[model samples]
Target: MFVRIVKLSFDPTKIDNFLSNFENQKNSIRNFKGCRLLELYRDKANTNVFFTYSYWDSEQDLENYRNSDLFKGIWANTKIYFNDKPLAWSVDKVVSLL
Candidate 1:
């Protein structure tokens, strides 16, 4: 599986908006082709910072989703509330006890 992690920091006043958007779109995102799992996390000391963790069948599956209209639309709606540029990474598991 290919892991995708994205770190996002949003404008303080826009946090609620982002959360609402995520809640509404989470299902569609998780149901996207090749998406194995999806999760969201927030920094305990930094309420505005959030992270999205997901697993895809492969890098191509991730690329396909990134190229889709669904991604474009979602990104467009989501980016406007960002306090800073978002960061993302594609990683692999070296070891996982689970």
Candidate 2:
């Protein structure tokens, strides 16, 4: 499994718009081919900061999603609300205590 996390910092005034967009696209994104899981997390102390965590079957699968029209639309819309450049990372598990 491949894990991906994208941390985003949005304009406080646009937070609700971002969340609404995410809510509209969440299901389609989760059901994309090779997608295993998806989640949205917001910082407790700063609601404008958030992270999207997802699991994909492989890097190729993730790439496919990235290249899709759905991704293009959603990402473009999301970017409009950003307060700063987003941070994204893909990682392989080395150890799992759980």
Candidate 1, residue 29: how far the Cα is off, in Å: 0.6
> What are the candidates' C-alpha RMSDs?
0.7, 1.2
Clashes of each: 0, 0
List candidate 1 stretches off by more than 4 Å: none
lDDT of 1 by residue, 1-98 (tens): 97999999999999999999999999999999999999999999999999999999999999999999999989999999999999999999678796
- lDDT (CA) for every model shown? 0.95, 0.96
lDDT of 2 by residue, 31-90 (tens): 999999999999999989999999999999999999999999999999999999999999
**Backbone collision tally, model 1:** 0
Judged by TM-score, which candidate is best? 1
Query: Judged by lDDT against the true structure, how good is candidate 1?
Result: 0.95
Model 2: residue 25 alpha-carbon error in angstroms: 0.4
Sequence-dependent TM-score of model 2: 0.94
Off by over 4 Å in 2: 95-98
